[model samples]
Target: MTIRLRLAALCAAALVLTGCGAVITSPDQVTPEVYVEQPSVSPAAAKRFGDDKAEQAYQEVTKFALEQAFPEAFLDPAKKTYTAAELTAGVAPHLTPTAAQGWSSLVTLALAGDADAQDSLRILQFYNVDDPGSELPPDGDVLVRQQITDATVDVEEPSGDSPERLLVSFRHEAVLAYAEAGRPYELDVTKTMSYWLAPAGANAGSTWLIASYDGRMDVAVDS
Candidate 1:
């Protein structure tokens, strides 16, 4: 039988069971890839605002934001560590300065091993088998993949026959598998993310940049 691990209750459970009996180990010089399910515009959205160029831009921005926020994607697989500067610089092209600044504290906290912060960032991967009867623990490499679906873009502000600010939302699901280990385990996670985008300059045709972002972790059930 598979048990679902809820990150929301991790901290309190950490106190009771030695933090789920799983140690966060740094992997080798191999960056695990996240398989992203490409964003698809709903039929309703296409009918409402059929701007393919803007839709593609929104999708690119969303993908970038997701990758930067995901620890498995940003961490230096070679060194098994990451720097705030690297994170900031990587996101500079896609996110506004203010938005990048807002992510600083969260990134700092997650790197510092803050459980709550990691949960809030939707990057925590450690799992524990609460059942005492479970077999051995996983002891091999880590593999992670995330899928995006039901993506839709909404024109929040239409200024004088032009789309000004756009809101993009999508559902994110991830499966972190440790199949090669002793008693292999996997963590299935689901999250919803939203991004607010606007032109970087006053000109309506300027490059699009993410102005704000929000994410929420949904309850994950074992498959």
Candidate 2:
């Protein structure tokens, strides 16, 4: 069988063995419970932004990190396990298959309601850079700083008695960091991602949903 076919089969087998139910379920079913509400920012602090839009943007930013960025970063083998090339060549296919074996492990994870898988999907759906810069970090000790500079949203007005719909645009900045061996270094990276919240209707709750998220890093250095 071709690589694509083999990958697909593996995915299908995994799904069956894991009892994930469906290969392409909606996001609502997969999202964790923690992302349902706005994050806390003190009223006095929030007033510095001076607008409801800013408040909404802040909420969306935190929500994206928790519900989308964290999960994607955790489960993505390119980011976590394999190199980027291996991911493209060895694991890119198998989203669908003619036989039961055609499902990929990522698909299985996604269908199985794995929180990490859900987060990965959320990040791809929401966070993207128009021009992704170089992946390599600079040589020598250096600290990187990143921040979000701008954002915008298009909200659809609710009909008769429905909730609003939302479309968002976000932007950010990043600074590279480099350090010598046996030296301590700190780097801070900020990201901004947008989201589209469909109007709340009878079937709306069944649509893509993100409830909450927590971000943590497990760091290990290899010699």
TM of each candidate vs. truth: 0.55, 0.30
Q: Please, what's the RMSD in Å of model 1?
A: 11.0
Q: Tell me how far the alpha carbon of residue 39 in candidate 2 is from the true structure, in angstroms, after superposition.
A: 17
Error of 1 at 1 (Å): 11
TM-score of model 1 relative to the true fold?
A: 0.55
Best by lDDT: 1
Writing each residue's lDDT as its tens digit, candidate 2 over 131-154 gives 122122334322222233344544
lDDT of 2 at 60: 43
TM-score, structure 2 vs. true: 0.30
What's the CA RMSD for each of the models?
11.0, 16.3
- The weakest ten consecutive residues by lDDT in model 2 span 1-10
